[model samples]
Every structure is written in C-alpha cells, then in structure tokens.
Target: MDVFEAIKSRRTTNGYFLDKPLSDEHIKILLQSASYAPSHFNSQPWRFVLIRDKARREHLGKIAGRSMREVMAKGNFWKRYLKYFRFSKEETDKSGDGIHIDNMPAVLKPFIKYLFSEKGGEMMNKLRVPYLLAIDSKKLVSRSPLILGVLLTKDEYKKDDLSGMYSLLALGMAIENIWLAATALGIGVQFISLPMEAGGAYWQECIDMVQPPENYELIALFRFGYIDPNAKRPTIDWSSTQRKPVSEFCYEETFGNKWIPKE
Candidate 1:
C-alpha cells in the first residue's frame, strides 16, 4: 500500500477481528518495522512482548474488564477525559476534533452527557453502564488474536535525563511504524488501556503478566487482529476520524501567527 494512503486509512478497530491467528511472516514484519524506527543516536530503547497464548489473553481480558468497570464507576474516566467527548453532530462538526459519541443504546441517548459526568456516578451505576463497558472490554481483548506489550529500557527511560525524553519520542515513532504497517497489512490495532488508566492492582497484574525484566518497564498494551467487516458495534461506541484543519493548528513560524496554505 502507498504510505500516504495507509496513513490516511489507518483506524482504531473497536469490534472483533477475524477469529484467525496472525501469520508468523506478518508478525515478523510488524516487529521489524518497529526495529527500523529511528531512535536518538540509535539507542533503540523499545522492547516488545507478544502475547498469543489463549489462557493468558483471557486473564488479561478479565483484568481489563474489571479495571474499566472500576475506573468508570469511580468517575476517574470522566474526570480525566470528558474534554475529548462530543455528544452530537453539531458539536463534533464544530470542533472538528475529539471523539464523537455517535453510537449507544437508546437508554443512554438522552442522558449521555450526564451519565459520563463525575456527578452522575450514582445514576450511571444504577443503569450499569460501567458493567456493560466491562463486558465489552473483556470480550474485545479476549477475542483478539494478539496482544502487544510495549516496553522501554530503564537505562534510557530516566525521567530526569535528556535520554528519557529521547527514549519516549523514539518509542512513539516506533508505535507509529507499527500502526502504519498494520494498516498496510489489513490488520487493526487498539490500545488495551483500562488497566493503565485505573492504575492499581489491575495495572500491576498486567505488569506481572507481561513479565518485563526489572530493567524494563511495560509502557503500553495493544490488541491486534484482522478486521471483521461483519462485526457488530458496541453498546457504547465512538468515532475520531474527524481532525482539525492544518490552518486551525499550524502557525506561520511564530506562535499564534496565522498560516495559510496554497490550494
């Protein structure tokens, strides 16, 4: 696939992937793509743990579900990410940014905003939205054909050192390489983030399962598989394809200066 086209078409797959394992050849390409990413002075601080075991995926799935439930129930999800939510076409169109909450059960349509607010925890719990999300999270992770555990070496990931920032930037590029490669291969990727977001025993369990060495830290987890065209959408779903125009964000060298591109 053309690089530009692959980048434009890349998407976060929310529904189930085809119930098939990834070929060893494709897995090699994915890892190889990451390895080729440029790092600061070629420090190459990233490491990956690929999880394809059935029982292990199931256990991680349960932890993800429980973490999602706890985070939403405790209002942490809302407190942190409410700014990135768009409830209607009007809002989404106006912002041209942020994820649009375009799909949900009819019961949530009326109170979607409130139900996602910190103050609505009691009412949301009554409706069991968190429980529903938990089930969805569990099923999604468990059904995935692969779970990628991304890690960074502690030697290069020092928070106070200049190499710390360099390692993080390098890893971001590596992940982007993985994403673009997956898009070219007709695979889909989505972050398995609830455990990280919840940040407690749930997160520790993930660390234990990934079993990173003491010198490395597990930084992120992502589920991967071929896209399932006939897969159904979740009870609560969102889309973030909308993006702000370059003019809306780019500047003419100096900050706040307007930038206009030629047609």
Candidate 2:
C-alpha cells in the first residue's frame, strides 16, 4: 500500500491476532522505517527491544493481566478510566474520540452501558466483576507473536528543555512510522497499555523483562501479528475516528479566526 493509503487505513487492532510470526525482513523494514523519523539535533532518543520468545511474551502478558486486574480490584476503574467511555451509539456518533459500546463484544455490550452508569459502577465495584476481563486480556497477550518494547532514554537535554520536548515528538513520529509500515505490510498491532497505568513497580517489572539499556525508560509496549479472521473484535465505527475538518482546529494567523480549506 502507498503511504497515504496506509495512513488513512491504520487502526489499532483490538486484542485479536493470528498465531503467526513476522518474517525477519519485514521486522527489519519496520525498524528501519522507525529510525528514519525526524529528530531534533538528530538525537533519536528512542530504542526498541523486540521480544519473539513465546515464554517471555506469555510471562509479560501475565504481568499485564495481573496488574490490570489488581487495578480493577481497587474499585477505582470507573473513576480512573471508565468515565471516559462513551457507551451509546448516539454519543459515539457525536464525539470524535473515546471507545464506543458497539465496538464491544455482544456478550459484554449489555454490561458496558450499566457498568459505566453511576449505580452500576458502584455495584460492580463492590462486586469487583471486571477482573475477569483482565484475565482474558492476559491470555490474548500471551498468544501474540511479537511483543515490542519502546524505551525512552535519558535526554542530554533536561525535561524542561525544548530539546526534550522535541525528542518526545520525534518518538511519536517514529511510532507512527512503524505503525504505518506494519499496516502497509498487512500486519496488525495493538498496545499493551496496562502496565503504564498499573504502577511503577508493575511498569518496572515489564521493562526489566525486556532488558533495555541502562537508564532507558519504557515508554510503550505493543504486540503485532497477523489478523485472526475468526477472532471476535470490538465493534468500532471507524468513521468516528476520522479527523474533523481543518476549520475546527486551524486558524488564519490568530486563534478563533478559522482558516477555511479550498473547496
């Protein structure tokens, strides 16, 4: 696929991937693509560690699952993240972001609306039933073929410095490059995001498994593999993810002065 086409079609795969390993050549291409992202002062402060070992991936999955479950057990899930969930189709259609209930599995869709409700959230928290979802997510992680860890190194420039901000932007560019490259190759990728929110100890354990360079911090984790046609995935109205017209966020030299695009 062409670059623009890949960019337009790229979407995060929801927890379902075929049990196939990516070829060495394809992997190299993705890494090379990531490396080409523009960096400030050419200080590419990002390092990638690819884990292909099944056992290690499984172990990491367990850590992610367990950590996620623990968070749910703390009864703060609704206050923490679920509040951001837009459950109704109407709500999803109106907003440009946040997860939609339609993208959820049929079995869980009914529960989602209630789970996000005030009384429902309180009751579920008391019951602590969401932990089961975490268990299944852990299995999904274990089955993934490739687990990639992205580490951010200590910048020569401090966090308060412009150089540090540039480095972060560059890292985002690098990740987008890899995602588009994988899309072009018909590979799917989904983030292993729980560890980051779980806590420092959980996050540290995840980084330790990858054995990254000293002082480098884990910034992101993801699993990539072929799509499993039979796997049930969250139902998403992809059109909702489309960007709003330029007039919405663009300006003509000053804020609030909208810049209209040529027809």
Candidate 3:
C-alpha cells in the first residue's frame, strides 16, 4: 500500500491469536522496512530483537501482568496514602533545574501522581501480547552524562534539542512501518513501553539472549501476532481520531502564516 493509505489504515491490535505464527519471510520484510527508516546523520541507531520463543514470551507476560496489578493497586490508594510516601530531597532539588521537568508546576503534582499511579499499570499489562519485539538504541548514540550530548553542538546546546527527538521520531516512523505491514499481513501488533518491574536489569538479560551489537541500548518493545477475524474492534469517532486539516497544523516561515494559500 502507499504511504497515505498505510497511515490512514494503521490501528493498534491488542488481542491476537496465539496459535497463528508469522512466517520468517514476512518478518524479514517488516524488519527490512524498519531498517531503512531515516536517522540523524544516517546513524542507524536502532536495533530490533524479535522474540518468537513462546516460553520467554509467557515469562514476560507474567511479569508484566504482576507489574500492572501493583501499579493499579497503588493508583487506587495513592491519594489516601500520600502521607506515607516520602518525597526525596533529590527530587525536590532537581525540580528547579533548567531541564524538562523544571517547567512543571507544583500544582500538577496530583495530576502527575494520577498519571504514574493509574494509567501506568494498564499500560504495563498491555505489553502481554503474542510476539514481543524489543527495540534498542546504539550505545554510541547515548554514552555521555547528558543523554542527548552526543548529538548537541556547543553552539546549539541550549537552543536546539532535536538530537534525541530526531532519533525517537525515526524509531517511531520505523514502528509505524512495521505496524502497517502487520496490518496488511493480517497480523496484530501493540507498542508498549517497558514496565518499571521489567527495568534495566531484566531488559538487559533479555537483550543478552539476542546478542546485538555491543553499542546498543533497549528502546521500546512490541507485542504482535494474528487476531481473530470475528473479533469486534472498539468504536471510535473517526473525525476525532483522524488527523486535523494540514492547514491547521502546517504554517509558513512564520507561525500562523498559511503556507498552502487559501484555495
């Protein structure tokens, strides 16, 4: 399918058929598409670890399930139990630092709490699907104390923060390519961020099994397989979910100046 058609049709598939296995050839094509995604200075920083082993997938599911439950339980009681939880001095000290978190207002604490406490668990459990794909970044791309230091220039350090953003956007593009391919092939796929329970150590163990290039770091994971044809998809308002008019999002050299021109 063409790019626009793929973009319009792609949807997240959570429920998958465990019995159906994707062919090696199909998997190859999907990876090939991902590998070609554009990156900063043509630095192909992303690596994918495809997990086809049923036993390992099951283990991941169990860990994710438990992690989800814990997060949900904490969310349900966090407000009432706020007094019992201690806020670290380090966290408070870093609040005013010129980093991304510096702009966060103290009033948003409850909202942040709700974000971490509530949806965090649901997002974790969403990882328990059929095939798990672990995405990693090359170590060379992120070896310094500052995560995006490798890509930042001395002159552009404070002004531009596009290095890491570009890498992630490229990775996201790769993911979209794979997801669309899966859709066309009648396969189901879900993108999931790693749960706190399956943190660095656990992920490192899984990555070691794949034996990727020495410079890679785990980035994201995906669960995929085939879905039952008879299953009903959740109803969504297409207009709300679909992209806004290009005129609304796009502009000329200056902000709000129409580039497309009034037709």
lDDT for 121 (candidate 3): 41
lDDT of 2 by residue, 139-217 (tens): 7788888999987777533488886678789899999999999998888888888877787788889878977776677
lDDT on C-alpha atoms for all candidate structures? 0.92, 0.77, 0.47
Best by TM-score: 1
lDDT of 1 at 97: 86
Candidate number that wins on TM-score, 1 or 3: 1
Model 1, global lDDT: 0.92
List runs of model 3 lying over 4 Å from the truth: 76-163, 194-214, 232-242, 257-263
Ranking by lDDT: 1, 2, 3
lDDT of 1 by residue, 93-210 (tens): 8999888888988988899899877688898899998999999999999989999999999999999999999999999999999999999998999998999999979899999998
Model 1 lDDT at residue 157: 98
What are the TM-scores, per candidate, against the unseen true structure? 0.98, 0.88, 0.57
Task: Specify the poorest-scoring 10-residue window by lDDT in model 2.
Answer: 234-243
What TM-score should be assigned to candidate 2? 0.88
Model 3: lowest-lDDT 10 consecutive positions: 140-149
Worst 10 residues of 1 by lDDT: 115-124
